[model samples]
Target: MATHLITGASSGIGAAVTRRLHTRGDTLWLLARNAGRARELAAEYPGAHTLVGDLADPGRLSWAFGHQSPPQELDSLLHIAGVVELGPIGDLTPKIWNEQLAANLVGPAELTRLLLPQLRLARGHVVFVNSGAGLNAHAQWGAYAASKHGLKALADSLRWEEKPNGLRVTTVYPGRTATPMQEKVHRQEGKEYDPALWIDPESVAQTILLTLDLPRDAEIQDVTVRPGS
Candidate 1:
């Protein structure tokens, strides 16, 4: 069985992916923000493993990982955890910008760096669950979009840098998924929430699985998922 590590597995798309993988008997190592969250995930997924590392504090991930045992080699590392805050650029504070950046961009980068040895050993795939905001910045989306755009850049550079080492990097940009994060976005925008109008998290999870199951002779560099009409 293939072994994988994933972030943001508590709910939404991350949870969807974890469920599918765990059901099929893939060994899973899930990242949780704290001890309580780790225990919760351990109970929820039964046999899956949990790692405690707060993405908001990217600087301490190494120290945090040192305290725990991570998988020796990984088939995939899914960077799916992120935080977002919506506001006009003028009204957005350094604190808001920093929080989003730390969770969305820098945390993923640091985590990948720390796990490169294990990934290279297994020729693993790295999937970044980005957003449509990464492609276009609308009003009130400046900070979150900026972080996602940086994520795209990170994925692009990593793909090239790790090509010879046999690491595959893919970024899946999903548009307005019906997630808790989307609900929060609606609240910020002062709009009504409609789950039917957005893409389902399970659909995105399937797309991710497709990339992972593809033949080793080919790779999907980037894919975008939009809600069906």
Candidate 2:
């Protein structure tokens, strides 16, 4: 079974992916922000492992992982954890921008850097769960979109730089899924959240699984999942 280290495994798309992978008997390492969260994920996934590192504090992640034992080799590193805040450019504060950037971009980069050796050993794949905002920035999506755009750049660069090592990188840009984060976005927009109107997290999970299951002869560099009409 392939081993995967997943961030944002507690809820939303991350939870869906975790459940699917666990059910398929894959080895999973779930990243949590703290010991309590790690315990919670460990209890939920049973045999799955847990790592504690706060994505909001990217600077401290190296120290945190140094204290814990991560896997020797990783078949895949799934980056799905992210934070979002919505406001007009004028109303957004430095703290808000920094918080989103840290959680969405910098944290994932640092985590990937820390795990590169393990990934290279396994000839692994890295999947970044980006957003539609990454490609197009709307009025209120400045900081979050900027972070996601940076994520796209990170994945693109990693794809080329790691090609010689047989590492594959992909960025999945999912549009307006029915997640807690989406609900928060709706609240910020003062709109109603109807689950039926958005893409299911399981659907995106399936897409991710497909990418993992594809033949080694080829790679899916980027894919976008949009809500069906």
Candidate 3:
């Protein structure tokens, strides 16, 4: 069985992906800020592992991964955790912008950097669960858009840098997924939270699974998933 580490594993796409991996009998290290929820996942799946800590804190992230010394190298690392802060460009505050960037970009970058050696040893795949905002900026979503844009750039750079090492980097741009985060976005936009209008998190998870299941010699570098209109 392949070994994998998944961030944002307590809920949303991360949780969906965790369940899929668990059902497949893969070794999973679930990381999320919700300690109790992470434990809940662990309890539900006796073989699943949980790391409860905030990715925004480097110390916490380091400690979480350090404590879990995997007997085998990782086959995949999925960075599905993200933050969204919506506001017009003029209304965006430094704190809000920085925090979004930290959660969406910097934190993932650091965690990936720390795990590079293990990933390289296994020639593993790295998947970044990005958003449509990373491809196109919107008026009231300055902070979130900018952070996702940075994340896209980081993914592209990592892909290029790690190609020689046989480590695959994939950026998945999912458009308006149906999740708690999307509910927050809908509220911020003063619109109704309609799950039907968005893509299912499980669909996104399946796409990720497809990417991971590709032949060892082939890789899906980038993927964009959107709702059917």
Best by lDDT: 1
Tens-digit per-residue lDDT, 1-229, candidate 1: 8999999999999999999999999999999999999999999999999999999999999999998999999999999999999999999999999999999999999999999999999999999999999999999999999999999999999999999999999999999999999999999999999999999999999999999999999999999999998
- How big is the positional error of residue 83 in model 2, measured in Å on the Cα after superposition? 0.6
Per-residue CA lDDT of model 3 for 71-91, tens digit only, reads: 357899999988887888899
Which residue pairs collide, candidate 3? Answer: none
Q: What is the lDDT of residue 152 in candidate 3?
A: 91
Runs in model 1 lying further than 4 Å from the true structure: none
What TM-score does candidate 3 get on C-alpha atoms? 0.94
- For candidate 1, the per-residue lDDT at 52 reads 95
RMSD of each: 0.5, 0.5, 1.6
TM-score of each: 0.99, 0.99, 0.94
| CA error at residue 134 for candidate 1, angstroms | 0.6
Q: Report backbone clashes per prediction.
A: 0, 0, 0
lDDT (0-100) at residue 71 of candidate 3?
32
